[model samples]
Target: MASLSVGVACVLLVLCMVVPSLAAVYTVGDTSGWTTGIDYSTWTEGKTFKVGDTLVFKYPTFHTVDEVSSSDYSTCTVGNAIRSDNSGSTTVTLKAAGTHYFICGVVGHCGNGMKLAVKVESSSSTTATTTTTNPDFSYSSSNRSSFAAYFITWVALIVILVINVSLWQEF
Candidate 1:
């Protein structure tokens, strides 16, 4: 019985540590996706963004996701984008606790309202559950790998729990 209790406690401790680090993933622009003319400012409302969360921009080949400085974002300056990608799907991990700016680099896109600004709070400030902009969202490779690893960890934990239960019963 004592051994079973100790095993259960260890499993619970491991789960507690791992659960807090699991980051939430969001799809930019929600159901409409990343495109011009949609009001991005409204999309970020009611969402609590935190450091370690991910922002996935899903758009067409003709469009681009550009991370930019606050000044550049305000002016729609495509030339000075901090980071740019036109791969159709851009996965951005929020690494800091500050406002992050993004825009579409294509000519006139940002001016036409293809821009997003998200305020990321420190993880220590709050905890939010994993979420998505839409019900239908796909994971990138990094996300897939991370999920697989987490699945394996849970399976191992369950096996340990079962073994402990069996041992307890035998004793």
Candidate 2:
């Protein structure tokens, strides 16, 4: 009975520790034909995004999501870049707080105003709230945690079963 109690407590503790590191999914680009540029005209900017928020690009053409300076387009040559193809999706995790810029790397795309900007607010607060209500954008933080918990639970259950079977001389 004591061993069973310990096992239950261990399982609960593991689950508690693993539930919050999951990745959330967020959609970028416009679903409707109204927004013609790489900019997230269909989405909101300057929202609070946690560390695990995945920005999904749902555009119909190839585009690059690059972090750039807020005022100068010359600094656009720097920062991390993600190139997504048409009808394809790329999930990028927000690691820090700052304004992230995106543009179409295709020839003359950026020059033609195919650019978008996103301001990722700091995620230091434990209870940060987002200000956008766009249906195309969504976020979830339990993806990684849920997978980890499921994996751990299965492994533990298998190990426990094997041990019990061995003790009962059934193996």
Candidate 3:
């Protein structure tokens, strides 16, 4: 039985090492880079942005990346930019679970609709949650389904192994 326990431990160790914590990297505007005449809203449609994911902006020297507030974004006001970058290539990570806005700082560029808005969700939100009106006790948060599956599987295997060992000893 010691060997069986060791084998189970080895399998668990391998699973822990193999299951990668993956994060997606999106190239903004696809092949067009972060420039004018690109429909950023359409590009991000049907896509779910999560924390840890990155947005890569590739543009020329004439254009600049400015992370601005929603009000500034709607009014094309780059003066209140939270973060500004002029490099040809820029990568911004979604560190928090909230909305992020980006726009070009060039005159009349943002007004010409050169902007992007992304809603970043928590990485732990793998399974979708549904709303419930039960006031007694409601579960509206994300359930750790992946971890629960792994734990249940491990417990079942251990139970099966224990039962098999008991039968073997009886013989």
Candidate 4:
């Protein structure tokens, strides 16, 4: 019984660690206007951002997403600048946790209040499960989601076996 408890505990621990490391993707721009841009006035921060999360900047016009300081505009230090030239997509990974300020690097753009700010909080130790539902589950499609379900089932079986072994050890 002791062995079984240990095994189950290990399985649970592994699941607890693996689930949160799964990175999430966030959109910085959409059809209406630039998200996390000067025109938007403000950008969603903190909880919306994670350590390994990627911020995708998608905009049509020439704009820059620069990380700057909140206190001083002249102290503008660029951290991650995404120009519209890079295939219309720039992905930035959040590495550190703190309040980050950004703005357009275009001439006269930042001056016109094209600045944005965001606060990145430290990652939580607990893992949270993320569920994504496919509204259109096509039976004919050979997509990643279809395969993922099978993979998850297989993993679950392995976990169950581990738990059983641990339980048997207790006896």
What Cα-based lDDT does every candidate model obtain?
A: 0.78, 0.52, 0.74, 0.52
Candidate 2 Cα outliers beyond 4 Å, as residue runs: 29-42, 45-47, 72-88, 106-115, 126-171
Query: How well is each residue in 1-171 modelled by candidate 1, as lDDT tens digits?
Result: 676678777877876787667888788988889998799989998998887788888889899888788888889988887778888988888877777888999989999999998887778846533322211222353663478478768868796878877888898
Span of 10 residues, lowest total lDDT, candidate 2: 132-141
Give the per-residue lDDT digits (tens) of candidate 4, residues 1-171.
665668767877876776556666555534543433345434463436655555555654566655444544444434334322223444556555554455666666666665655445556755533421111111231333345457567778997887676668769
Q: Model 1: residues >4 Å from true position, as ranges? A: 125-140, 144-149, 160-171
lDDT of 2 by residue, 1-171 (tens): 556567767776865676555555565653542124534543655444565565666544454544344443434443334333343344456655555555555556656666666555555665434442111222233345457668877868865775586568743
- The lDDT leader among the candidates is 1
Clashing pairs in 2: 24-140, 39-116
RMSD to native for every prediction?
Answer: 6.5, 8.0, 11.4, 10.9
Model 3, span 93-163: residue lDDT tens: 77767778889999899998899988777779564233211111111222234455676688668768876
Weakest ten-residue segment in model 4 by summed lDDT: 132-141
Off by over 4 Å in 4: 1-17, 30-42, 45-47, 71-87, 111-113, 125-171
Clashing pairs in 1: none
What lDDT is obtained when candidate 4 is compared to the true structure?
0.52
TM-score between candidate 1 and the true structure: 0.77
Considering lDDT, which of the candidate structures 2 and 3 is the better prediction for this target?
3
lDDT of 2: 0.52
- Error (Å) of candidate 1 at residue 24 is 1.3
Give the lDDT ranking, best first. Answer: 1, 3, 4, 2
Count residue pairs with overlapping backbones in model 2.
2
